[model samples]
Target: MQTNDAFSFLMAWAAAPFRIGSVTPSSATLSALMTKEVGPDTGPVLELGPGTGPFTRALIEKGVRENDLTLIEADSDFAAMLTKRFPAARIFEMDATGLRHMALYNGPVLGAAISGLPFRLISPRRTRLILEGVFANLRPGASLYQFTLGLRCPIDQTLLDQLDLRATRIGHTLLNFPPATVYRISRIPVTKSYDWRYA
Candidate 1:
């Protein structure tokens, strides 16, 4: 990450720590881990709370085309910076909870959804709403990767069951400021399809 990116993240956190999440930008290791499952062949991707574009940069390095990426940043300053930094990608200045309303996002079925949002700080209801919005626009088997400072998964288990989704601990990095772990959430695979041929 660049010095300006770090400075912008710090300033944004200083203003609203809850919204900005981390006091420092994510470490390179964490960024790489968060986007490990995504690649050029992974199809279009969606990113939430791309504060300073750490993960965004990592995604590009992983072979994801800039034009195929959609970034949602609630903070206007960060969103503007991301727009300039990733001119080819579509950037939206809107809350994650309101993602369902974005016309650009509603059209495409995402291959992956990477989140830098602070789920620990958000209420369970809001978290459910955001996840619902993301999954609604994602293709079957597409994964949502999220990094959290907490030890356990940030999202509730009940919500996972309700959505028929499953979570896997993909990676953890002690190199980040406070240490972070990445979780991959995806719909449970269907074992069989029912038919009435015998009946």
Candidate 2:
């Protein structure tokens, strides 16, 4: 999609009265807003709230096959748009918090989670709960890629502290609306959480 389309998409989302924070598409920030962790080449990939498929397009451009990607969006309007936009992708009309409830064991091991959800206003508890579900289901070496407006980190630090997850600032891209920074989150050293994948 073009930059103008991105702007229009964000504007519509902004007007939705949804909890979604920014409607701005950070296509330019897609690459920078990702962790260098999730190895390229292959693995089942999950994208949260892929508004207008901005990062979804970038992920395909970065070598992730359309079939290997799963696009999840809670917005019915946006979900319908994604279904038409990327016929090759698997679009889920659901919220990120309820991901674990969805049965997805038939695909490749989850290697990465690229979240564009409005996490700034989201509480750390809810964020941790969602991440816990994602992490528990991920494979070893899997990574969570999140873009944030604040140039500081991907997910909030206070949330990180509460979840016992450690995040490293991989990179940042200022070309996006309000700009953003990407962070890689993983279990800090060793934390008992029934999943070694996050460790």
Candidate 3:
């Protein structure tokens, strides 16, 4: 596919009703961020809002089995597009917050969530809710991959503390527009509370 075609697809989705605010096509850096950290996608990998599936495609190309991919996309149009693009992968038309209610695979899931959702623009309550659901659904040692143009992800420290999620900078993508940083946050035992990371 031409670069413009792929670029247009991502731009259109980000501008759609869902308000997924990516200013550019997902960068190569964004796609590579988690693959290097997830280290061998041997189990089920859940991708949220896989708009055009940049990360999904990367994961598949890196050795993840087609059947082990479960994508949760909120946009019906995008979900339908993903279904066509990746017939071997499972697609769910649900929001991230509803993850706890869904049926998951029986085997151990790879504790990595590749999030392309626009967390910086979303409300704190909504963000926290989704993180909580992710925490509950994923086993310990599972990590969340999030990238943002801002120096830090907009999630508040209190929210992170409440969910016991700890943040570690995986790397940065200076090639992206406005540049961006990637973080791999995992759940850890917390003895003290912290103020909101956003605050």
Predicted candidate 3 versus true structure: per-residue lDDT over 1-199, tens digit per residue: 3376366566675567345776455766668875666646446777887877878888887778777788988877778888988999989988888876664665335567778888877788889878876666566577778777778865778888877778888788777665878878788864666779957
Residue lDDT tens for model 2, 1-199? 4766676676676776345677666655555456345435747788888877777777787778888788888878778888988999888898788875665665337878888877777777777777877777667767788777786664667777877777877777767677777877766666546777876
- In order, what is each prediction's RMSD in angstroms? 1.9, 5.2, 6.5
State which candidate has the highest lDDT: 1
What is candidate 3's CA lDDT for residue 72? 88
Clashing pairs for predicted structure model 2, backbone only: 10-23
Taking the tens digit of each residue's C-alpha lDDT, what string does model 1 give over 1-199? Answer: 6788889899999999989888899999999999988998998999999898999999999999999999999999999898888999998898899965554554547899999999989998898889888988898879999999967998889888987888899988998989999999898887886788976
Q: How should the candidates be ordered by lDDT, best one leading? A: 1, 3, 2
Compute the lDDT of residue 182 as modeled in candidate 1: 96
* Candidate 3 runs further than 4 Å off: 1-18, 190-199
* Top TM-score hit: 1
The TM-scores, one per candidate, come to 0.93, 0.82, 0.84
